[model samples]
Target chain A: MSSSSNGNGTPILELSDVHTYYGSIHALKGISIEVHDGEIVTLLGANGAGKSTTLRSINGLNRPRQGKISFQGRDITTVAAHEIVKRGIAQSPEGRRLFPRMSVIENLEMGAFQRSDRSEIRGDMDRVFELFPRLHERRNQKAGTMSGGEQQMCAIGRALMARPKLLLLDEPSLGLAPIFVERIFDIIKQINDQGTSILLVEQNALMALDAADRGYVLETGRIVLADKAAALKTNEQVRKTYLGET
Target chain B: MAADASVPTLANRLQRPSVVGLLGVVVVGGAAALLLKNLTVAPSRFFEVTLIGLTTGCVYALVALGYTLVYGILELINFAHGDVFMLGGMFTITYSTHFFGLHHGQGPATILIVFATLVLAMLSCGLINATIEFIAYRPLRGAPRLAPLITAIGVSFIIQDIGLAWKGPNYITAPDVFPHSRVFSFHGVDYGWNKLIVVVITIPVLLGLLWLVQQTRQGKAMRATAQDKDAAAIMGINVNRTISFTFLIAGALAGAAGLCYSLYVTTVRFDQGFQLGLIAFTAAVLGGIGNLPGAVLGAVLIGLIQTWNEGLPWHMPGSDWTQSIVFSILILILVFRPEGLLGERTPEGG
Candidate 1:
């Protein structure tokens, strides 16, 4: 199934025939996808399905050996990971990837490292606090000292501090408690509503589908399915393989 | 819960004597006895030695700070750090005597000459260190951790060889440019201006560095990078440039220490870096290798111990045992209090 690319404006990010490798292992074999402005696109896959690899390739952490990645209509395939963030794209990354020693506020400040807007940055900090009040309570506490769910909040807040036009979130719900998983999905939908594009990766098919506008099913470095999220939620193969509804 | 209560707490475990406990007792007990024995005689001498120790300790602290800073970011020891310190000293000596024609007791010119040498040495060493990071370490970043470490040692040797060619094997005398006025005199023990000058420069350099690493935006990037390099990049921090900045700051510190040692100790030798560098490295490890303040504390402790052992009126071991004692402290700290005095022992985050 092909997800309808209707009504949405120009593509904010597009990957064409992207193939990425890790040493001898070919992780992403010629996968193509696009995320339009102001839409949520979820990449659905199991472990080792190259979902994270796709995000990594887009962010230039693992540059695609063979293909082009364009963001906002400019080629970013060879850009450095840090430079990619400066180009209106940010990733919260796998495992939260927090600076364990830094406080939550400092972690947020780091997300805005490339930006020099002091008052505006402070305003965003307040906005983040409003979004995740638990972070406000522990703003001075080290990221490592926080609970896993709180650390996950800090991670998302950090990426938001960049004020990116497009945010790549990898496994945002991974290892979170079920309650937190629900809250995270809620925040993802809320964030998408605020005009920022999102490319989300998740193993929680039901929650991802509930929040995303479009979905792609990946297995062993290839996309086997792409469709509207409603279609994916009801698709026979998605239900049997990922939704645990055989 | 009752059964769990029966398990020994850390304090209870210590109460039951083991081989490790006995070793700790022997080491602490021996050190206390030696210190007590020395303090009982010629207390004035002890006071004098302490004043002298603090001055020299400041020098060690400057160099030790370099090691800890680089280690904090990269986890690489930057073994070449000491040679950079050595070259800083060489630069100080050359720029002062050869370039400026500075001599002993030149009044106001002494201050100007010394300041000039400080800036020149610091800037040159900073660039050299940054270059070293760009050339030797960056390429090996993807290799095993040991690769960078080995390359550090190799870079250290190359710098040492350059120093050897610059000034040969002999100890080169540095012209005393600092004023020799006495800061204070009591019971015929006077603290001179020469010692005061070293401390004056060292305190601000250390405090400035602490501020940079703790308070500034750049400092936040550094701490973040140190904690997680990949994560720092994800946050839009230029990790490569941050690493280079760390090296530059560390190199400037080496330059500051170089200038201090040249003026106060009054000599520079090509092979001196290996000896002093090892001592500073010992200081770094004893204070917890990657900790900043711990590095300074450890350096002072080592400096005091060395001075006391050599200068005490009691059964002193003399200056020859200084290296052995300092290195023994390194081994003992590794075996016992490896986290260092001021450092927190963090469990591996992963």
Candidate 2:
């Protein structure tokens, strides 16, 4: 956490003293973190740990009651959800949230909703279909009818269609088999390799730590630990609790 | 760039015939059979029925667009929209008869006045519908699907009661401003100018709306929001505003249709929207609830069926059976082709 603020490489996104509440129950409390440009930052925690809240807060879906969220050197704390997206932030929300009744091609088209350049949109669609050939094969098929792994691929492809500088993924590996999980993680790495900074939220700590450059551990609405992924992966407490070590 | 390399595969998939192709075949085949049949029906009666049907169909399409647009975005039934359309016609009649003191066959000036009044009535209906969305529907959003639906029905009954209180269940005679004249004859068929006016006016309005949805930036935003609200919001679309705009447009179309019905038919009442709304709802479902062109096609088909049902001789169905027949056909269509004629199942994660 200390190494996150060297001024040499300014953070792409920063959240300070953030708080969020759902009705009367507090969801995220006094959470602070920084994500540098081009970094793979993973937030790992158990269920109800506020990992999703942190990501949603950035996009203004769940606005923090008190805090500052700065993205690319601009304060986005009070910005509307849709406007936040225009500023080059995109989220592949939990549960995929795909329009189940629309065609695969139509789903991808929606990804570029804010963009006006027709040619660029076409180009982005082409790029997405390339990454997931299954999506290409089923371009006319309804996304809800696809298999879990394929749907996850479509979700990722849909996010990429936005061509965002920062992509937030909430539980991309949920409800997936082991092989599909490995494949999804590989694709995530590939997407990050292509220069899109990522903020991944997952309960699958082992895999997330393996893929992330740095990691944060949250528990009961607070950040309990933050460190380099390599160090966190070997940390005694993390190993015993999250990594299933004997 | 990595994703672009797989274009050939997607192109191949897109080229395959979808459900839309099958529906086209059925519709075309049915229409051809109807045209090809040279029945012994009376020519005069057939012409009259066709004219009436076309006018009725145009009105149905106008009302159905409201259902389709609202359903396209919110997926809500908007049971109250029909009453709103009825109120629009009532308002037009009130203004033309009571306020302006306009009467039947007064000249082209009266025609111009009627048109102006009709436009104002439609605009007012649009504003009312927008207000309804803001006040009633907006609060119930994200609660549950049934909550808004129930609220819509409640609103429908409330409007109906208001109309009953205002007009007292009496049939109001709409002022006939246009001169009653048969404009021309085509192959022994007399063409009335009023019928021509309705078609000419309606065609352009429908085309304009279609263009607005397909060609304009607002149209793109609408489609985007319809497909996925969160994604649209993510892309900088204000979901609430878009939904409100949709309601306004739908309301205006229905209002204009009501005005046209009042002028063309010569009578209007509080309960007119109830029957017309049901017909339009059926048309929307028949064509595909959210598809634009589908609604128009369904309306025209319904119009034709209704006319033929009444006019065709040699043991054809009675007028009394029209509602039952239309609904029965609707059920069949749903059972066999749930997506409607031109509609497709929307994709997930749009």
Compose the digit string of candidate 1's lDDT tens values, residues B1-350. 01124543343445667888888889879878977877777767878898899998999999999999898888888889999999989999999899999998788878888888899999999999999999999999889999999999999999999999989999998997777778998666888989999998899889999999999988988888888888888778888999999999999999999999988999998878878988998998888888999899999988888898889878877888888899988887766666667665563211
Give lDDT tens digits, candidate 2, residues A112-184.
7777788889888888887888899999997767877787888888888889999999999999999989988
> iRMS for model 2?
7.3
Q: Tell the DockQ for candidate 2.
A: 0.30
**Which residue segments of model 2 deviate by more than 4 Å?**
A1-11, A16-30, A65-78, A98-109, A115-163, A172-196, A203-207, A240-245, B1-38, B41-44, B94-118, B164-168, B183-187, B313-317, B327-350
TM-score of each: 0.95, 0.80
Q: True interface contacts reproduced by each model, as a fraction?
A: 0.72, 0.58
Winner by lDDT: 1
| Candidate 2 Cα deviation (angstroms), residue B305 | 3.0
Candidate 1 backbone collisions, by pair: none
DockQ values of all predictions: 0.50, 0.30
Give interface RMSD, every candidate, in order.
7.5, 7.3
